[model samples]
Target chain A: MTCKEAFQEISKYLDGELSEELKRALHEHVGRCAHCKVVFDTTVKTIELYCDGKLFPMPENIRNRLHDLLRRKFHERAV
Target chain B: MHYTSMMALEVNRLEKGTDRLTGKSMSAQPQKATERAESELIAEAKAGNGDAFEELVNRYERRIYRLALRLVGNTQDAEDVLQETFLKAFEHLPDFREDSRFYTWIVRIAVNEGLMKLRKRKSDRSEPIEDAVDDQGQVMPREFRDWKPNPEQLLSQEEMERVLLDAAHKLPASLRTVFMLRDVEELSTGETAEALGLTPGAVKARLFRARFQLREELSKVFKSEKSLDL
Candidate 1:
């Protein structure tokens, strides 16, 4: 596969959606090409960085307010 | 019990006529137990049980908030989306058909609320949320330097979050929503498509563009400049 084809398939490759044939071709392309390898590795890292749950913890105050708002709404409806 | 297990239990009960009064089959299946509990909670909430509804709220609030924060790009609007999502869900709980999982149903509501928040903010702007252009021309990797491993170790969590959020905010809302739902929220492509009212093909294409753009944006910060310079 060419670098362009490999690059286009990176997302599908990571998402586990690539067919076996395309996957093998892209894997071979990245394994041999330094540039495609960097792009593929960094893209993997990019997903990891965003997916870390610590990056965006929900604040306790916000949680409290949400529960409080729900309580009030429920109470008013009950009345 | 699982269907097969339940059938076996029923057959055993019929043959042996034992454990008929103990309800032993219900105790053996954890998956069914959880489903039964959820259905009971839904039924109770639909019958005006506030506590049961709160139980459901507690189950999904953090995830909903995170999704809202990612989509709307702020704590305040995220909070508004969270509050509005549950409020609206509660108001319409009785109308909720059981065909969909409650989480998916609530996620749909949260997405709508987030979209409304985005729409209100973008009213003066001309960019449409649905970006239909072919993004392939823009997706080529210009930065070929490998990123340093363990970037979390290099940057504080807050700094990392800022960098990530800024990169995410760079995409048009269309691609951002698909990426956030499919990647960040870990929703299935089908579920994300359904929530956004787009086809699975659209979701896949936009997800590709979003991931490529985000990687490119982040590479600006995390790339190994020393190697590239050499």
Candidate 2:
């Protein structure tokens, strides 16, 4: 795969949407090309890090505030 | 019972079963359990069960808050967006069509709330990122370099995570939301498109742009100054 093609396919590869054949081509391309390999490795790391949904946990204070607010609002609506 | 495994037994993602694209498993056992439990929660909420609604909120608060924080660029505004989104979702619970996942529906509300806050908040957003896009074409960043995180220069995990968050925050609101839901939340591409009210193709385009921008920005931090030729 060419550099441009590699760039374009990066999302598909990370997303697990690539066909096996295309996946093979992407792996082969990145393996042979140092530059593309760097981009690919960094991208893999980036996706993994970003996928950490826990990175920004909701603070307990906010959680309690949300809960209290919901209670009051729902109670008012019920009445 | 464990959250997901328990949910898995009771409900299958009915939507997943009949998803036109996959059409693989409508009666899949595990998915059925998840959908059943969630469906019950929605039904209970609709019937004036505050506790049921809160259970739903508990499941998604962190993710929703994180998206809000990233989109509006601060904890204060993120808090407001989170509050508004749930309030609206609660008020509209009776109107929720069960065809879509509750998570998908609420995310739509959060995105709208986030964008609205963004517009009002940007009056003081000194040189906002959007300003960089004088021309729509110029808005897309394309200057990519081959930079890997070298071992010697590798920062600690926490530091690298901070850099990653910074890069994500730099993304435009539209792109950031798409990336967050699709990548971080692991929503299907179709679900992301539906949440954002765009075509799947459009979602893919924005995702590509978001990923490319992130990859390039991250390279600056991790990539050695010595450049390599392809």
Q: What is the lDDT of residue B108 in candidate 2?
A: 87
lDDT string for model 1 (B136-167, tens) is 33567778888876677898877887888788
- Proportion of true inter-chain contacts also present in candidate 1: 0.58
| Model 2 interface RMSD, one decimal | 9.9
Q: Where is the poorest 10-residue window by lDDT in model 1 chain B?
A: B21-30
- Superposed Cα deviation of residue B108, candidate 1 (Å): 1.2
Error of 2 at A58 (Å): 1.0
Q: Give the CAPRI class of candidate 2.
A: acceptable
lDDT of each: 0.78, 0.70
The residue-by-residue lDDT of candidate 1 on A8-68, one tens digit each, is: 8877766676787986787677766878878876776676566666567899999999899
TM-score of each: 0.84, 0.78
lDDT of 2 by residue, B1-230 (tens): 43323222222322132321233432212343454488788999999999999988987888789878767767889899999999999999989998888888898899899888877866876424342432123223344465544432366655655676678777777777787777666577898988878889878877777777777777667666676664
